[model samples]
Target chain A: MTKNPIVNGKLVCVALNDSEQFNAMQAEFAEAPYKGAPTQPVLYFKPHNTWSTDGAVVEWAEGADSMVVGASLAVVFGKECCRVSQAEALDYVEGYTLVHDFSLVEQNYYRPDIKGKCLDTTAPIGAEVVSIADPQALTVITSVNGTVVNETPVSQLVRGVAELISTISYIMTLQPGDVIAVGFPGQRAPVAKGDNVSSVIDGVTKLNNVLGN
Target chain B: MKHARVLFNGSTLDVTVEDSFSETGQLKSKADGQLINEADVTWLSPIAEPGTIFALGLNYADHAAELAFAPPTEPLVFLKGANTLTGHKENSYRPDNIEFQHYECELVAVIGKEGKNISREDAMDYISGYTVCNDFAIRDYLENYYRPNLRVKSRDSLCPIGPWLIDKDDVGDISDLKLTTHVNGELTQEGTTADIIFDLPFLVEYLSKIMTLKPGDMIATGTPKGLKDMQPGDTVVCEIEKVGALVTNIVSEQEFYGDKY
Candidate 1:
């Protein structure tokens, strides 16, 4: 078995306690969200106020509003790419994994854009990462609470995975530590606490976890 | 809950979340290096505020076909503001007379570290975790351009996000994750992570090139097929596999503001 590292950083803040594991990507404070993936590779940053750790827990604010669960595929950057080109983009990838991108939404509240997107314990990523791949021969499956919610072929994506990497390289310089989350299927529904969710890419790896409060 | 800062230390980024930096942590000194504690944090964005927001256009094969366009050759990404995130359990109000709000269940991305142009090789190192979001768009205002702008997509509170963040390492191969959307307990949208036109590694590398992805930035990955309109009083739940779900309610203009007057 290959070594599967969580963050591979030095400073980790989990559950209001604990110490470092692997720090997050640098430049986060200075970066901003894209103005659209290609036209203007923008930058955004979330304060450290956004991290949550180990078996992260989310809530509906105890009936203050509504809630649901989501599952996704994420990529862990092996290295960095700064204004790199398509030709050199492939070399920077570390590989792929899973992430439980969770969030809390109040009906009409929207501010501190980073606050909602950067909530503690709002991000849950998987540990299974394959060291290498050609981008074409991968398979992916999405499930919730033991139910097969979505099934797709890598060949169906609107953009072949590799090209996006190259395009992004042209916009921003890739760094040693970064994450790329592939899009998710559109047919699944929300799961509450006690719901088990799992996903598996046929020739790749599987992401399995349970949703909880 | 703690207040933390994810920033570049020389060339690396570290996440420092204090328990209460916002309301309690006394800024001992005026220097940026004030004795900050993970506690007393007042400046933290509740997992809903993304440093930068990323959205997709017609990534859903079905939605694409409905729009009569070939499946995109690449992911169609767009941007929004951290100011657009709504509370996870609160209610979202539709603009006056706008077509009923439509909810697109999507896989939301959260960066753990900072990366300039992140290569797929070392991409994993940058991630802290992931979450889900209801990429709410005001269909009535969305115009001809495939990319919805202020008229349709960027409405305040149109984006519903929430509850937790899972470390990227804890959840494996995300490509196959699932997404589910519920409108008042009725299943409305069913999708999977497998359909993502741009996989995670590529997204990071591609996105990083376009912009510098900082810790806490939120990416609302493309939504799947089955896009539907939401109405007042309808609760929308966006559930993704592994990642917890985000729930939000829909309200009418009259109900949006309960007598702030």
Candidate 2:
């Protein structure tokens, strides 16, 4: 059973080496943490096991005790980039979507290499993966069961989407449909069984789901 | 009954089971043509610029001895990237000028969450399960460079993974699983997970302190002895005791000539 994740019309993989995300992250580290270079981009890998179709229905895994939710914008890439200029980064983008990368916070975050990402039903994506947009004008809003919790404008990113792509390109090759999940705004408050969590981006669309037992 | 990840028509799948695991015959038949077996097709690598491909060095005492390194005090840890991985049953393509490329067969644990400051008492709960891994490498991918780069490790196809992920819990004691490597039917490397210097839980606690590990992440536990220099046309086979075996071949590196590096 291959986990082929698709959002809009693109396959979900990565355009690695378009190290723009890491570059922006370093720039962010300079001020945010009052630190020096980050040395490395917050690089990540999504094996075939991690993908969920946009808006795919996700159920709690067997023996699962609880649940959690997150609201964020998933920046989707359309073309491959490997050391492209920041200005050219947007050209590789296919579009954007309101992606909900759900996980079990109760699962230890300390073992991300083992537990957090591989839970049988780890990612619960949203439907209506919107294509092409003005990211500058977008605002992401997160709510737990409909009441707003955290909100931020896309422009506030420590590293804009373009800058991050350039940073990542320097390390590895970025393939088409590679997604740049911008960092969480404030905190991704956890959701429990019977709780509903959702999000909406001014231009990216909206996603909603209820934690099931 | 549940969704399991697989590969179909060149893409890995997160498939929902129309049946059950107890129904092995039913599972295989239901997934026969749909689920491509590791030995049946060319396996491409699953990671690209992976934030970090973590490895627990000297897991097997036999491997530690062959390399002339003393057994580690704790898990001997190191990091690799998207370049280190190749697909299961893939062509372990090598550049013409390169020598000393080798294969290490081992178990892999896939992370399902962002782990940090986790304790051993709670570690097992984090791992999804175990799977097969062949950690192939070019002994000297570094040309005197202090740091490793994708250019040396990141060949189009390097690490080959998967027959299917066997749930870690079902694997019983992870530290003692058996594995053997055969080059064209000549058994070379053999060992067990029991030799690992760093067990899974401690590794989780150790890594989370340095960096944030995310879901879908992979950890190559380490390999056993039987290390050998692979040549073109050589068939590299890795067999895990109860788990399935993965067999890949060495291919010619015709594409490297055009690269800028």
Q: For residues B168-206, could you state the per-residue lDDT of candidate 1 as single tens digits? A: 665667888888888889898888878777777777887
Model 1 segments more than 4 A misplaced: A1-213, B1-45, B144-146, B259-261
* Interface root mean square deviation per prediction: 15.0, 9.7
Q: How does each model score on TM-score?
A: 0.47, 0.52
Question: Which ten-residue region of model 2 chain B has the weakest summed lDDT?
Answer: B142-151
> Scoring each candidate complex against the real one, what DockQ results?
0.01, 0.05
Clashes of 1: 191
Superposition error at A100 for model 1 (Å): 39
Q: How close to the true structure is residue A21 of candidate 2, measured as C-alpha lDDT? A: 39
Which 10 consecutive residues of model 2 chain A have the lowest summed lDDT?
A: A9-18
Tens digit of per-residue lDDT, candidate 2, span B1-261: 222344556755444333343454222323443543323333334332233466665677778888797887755554444544555566666766866888878777777666656777777777776667777767765322112233444444466766555566556677667888899889888787777667788888766543446665677788877789888888988878655576787776653223522
